[model samples]
Target: MSGYDIVKTRETLIMALKQDDEKAWAVFYELYAPVIINFARKRGCPKELAEDVLQETTMVLMRYLKNFQYDRKKGRFKSLLFKITESKVIDAFRRAGKISRLRNSELFSKATSEDHARIITERENIWDNEWKTMILRESLQEAKKRVNSRVFKCFEEVYLKEKSVEEVAEQLKVSPNLLAQNKFRVMKIIVDTAKKMIHNLEKS
Candidate 1:
């Protein structure tokens, strides 16, 4: 199978990882390391600190994935990942003597149970947003490979580059109707692909 097919689903990759498949581990790291780094960066970590969190998170996963249980009814793989990355972020902060910064920031108040719950909820929201952004980005790349070059270009100009449909059509010398159709078709492909990607992680 192609690397894309092999790494397409989290469950499949996790199973491969459990068997100590080196390629599967590489694919897993390629897919998730950025997500962890970006999550840490959003939480105000510098690039160096974010890279530290990524390494720490990867080590934790390596130590745990041998027996990791992926029960969807219990929780999502993404959430487990988020929890791990979050723990690493906190640890990195502590090492840098910046835990007080997080506690004193707007996201945290007094460290009470209520505050702790609120912190999790807020941080989860941030994590989810970053995760979705990464998925959309990957989906867009896949969409480009699946669609016509012109169609993908139209979609990029109109949707991603924020160009008007009329302007793109005129520039590309295509009818506005054609541009709209291309936009809709590419959007469907991207959204569908993104949903499937999310399901691969969250559902199974």
Candidate 2:
């Protein structure tokens, strides 16, 4: 498969998960662990705490996923996973006494309904940012696999590393115009691939 193999539908995966299938659990971890870790880190968790959240969230998923009722009308799988991961992060902070500091904040102690809504929106933004980041990274990896290796390297240098385009063009002995074309072409592939992944993620 060029990108993530979308072989398992959400329903099929859930059924396998409910059966205690080891492979299904492994797939679940590989797909979601990074999102959980990044979500925690973005929420101000330390490295250790973020890792703890990953472990705790994994356990929680294993315990509860077997009985999960998948209903797209209610929410997507990511939303359910986000709620569990967010809960684990809060528990980690509570244990580390960080929640106490947050609790003492005026925003926490004297927040209005609007204030609470803002907090929820901010967290949702963080989650979406991390999710999209992961999608882009995976999409880029798939693009790399399909693109000419040397051209892709040049694209990375000029586009991602933000090196002087003139310098990179001279070193690579390619025209700046050629580099520009490569950038545009490779970016199109990445964006297209990411869109497919996002569609699957939301609908699977």
Candidate 3:
């Protein structure tokens, strides 16, 4: 993610958590939950097991966010999420009987020694970040396309304006409750579409 994307996502999450906004939590889930599933699948988990792991991992995330630390200097939200993913992937693989042998349990061992051969970190591509930035940019564009100008503008007022959702609702003459739900709806569509676009871009 670019610096701006990271900052935006982090700010949105923090504000939502502060307000105990269920809609914001749901948006966050839509953006990240698929990543856990994909990571499990890549680590050789079966489809059912992959889904289970994704659920388990998300539950863990929910548990942590009550006390979760958002550290930009340490890395982007992607890194924190990926660290959870890496742990959950290993756990899923273990449960699926892929690594019963003791010596092969280490992350280093898995990357270096597995027959399917995960990419060693030393050789991992930097294009991943570029791809993510493109996807996020496109997803925001797609989200903007689906909503009424007023609804999209309401989202901008609340999220982009740093105004409270309550403030946005009053500005638009809509209910605050409705405004909050709309916030998540638009964000989810944009994020999911962006992920798909990025995946297609990578294939090309």
Candidate 4:
């Protein structure tokens, strides 16, 4: 799920989906599971509902693989995952409303109150932060393994710990100029890696 040697891209996903490959299924799950879960939870779903949404969305992709063809023109796979999460979350809400008269529950209403609005806002912010962190952490971990340890150490000091280039140069006994170069080097690694992973996600 988090590696840098991968060559599989969007075309690979389409081929895998058409053939129903297990590796393709795993790749698809790795890319979108956290996104769907976080998206559902951010939309006020309970934890169980968030998980259910993730599962349902995955099944929808697997079962209806032929129903919706992959198209970059439709948008990136991240957007497609959000669409899937939104649809599943709404379906859950509608089903819950049908079963529970508490669609209008006081506790649910309180979620919109000024006093509780802060809570809802904070929850959404936390979820967004977590989602971004998940992607960055995965990217960092994969990038770390692929590149030189010394270069990654410079990156950790400068970007991960917010150290100044001067500080990193002093700590690593490297020239500031070299530190700056390493920063770009690490950035390129992560950006390229994540783009590949994220672009092909949600395909199946």
Which regions of candidate 4 fall more than 4 Å away from where they truly are?
1-10, 66-80, 98-138, 194-204
Model 1: weakest 10-residue lDDT segment is: 1-10
Q: Give Cα distance to truth, residue 59, candidate 1, Å.
A: 1.0
Best by TM-score: 1
By descending TM-score, how would the candidates be arranged? 1, 2, 4, 3
Shift in Å, residue 19, candidate 2? 5.3
Question: Whole-model Cα lDDT per candidate?
Answer: 0.81, 0.80, 0.62, 0.70
**Model 4 C-alpha lDDT per residue in residues 20-122, reported as the tens digit of each score:** 8777677656655776777777777899998999899887776666665656677655555556666788799887783265456777655556856785566
Two-way lDDT contest, 1 vs 4, winner: 1
Q: Write the per-residue lDDT of candidate 1 for residues 42-136, one digit (tens) a residue.
A: 99799999999999988888888777776668776787789999999989889998978766877566468987788789899988888787777
TM-score per model over all chains:
0.86, 0.82, 0.51, 0.68
lDDT of 3: 0.62
Clashing pairs in 2: none
Q: Rank order by lDDT, top first?
A: 1, 2, 4, 3
In model 3, residue pairs whose N, Cα or C atoms come closer than 3 Å (at least 3 residues apart or on different chains), thus clashing, are none
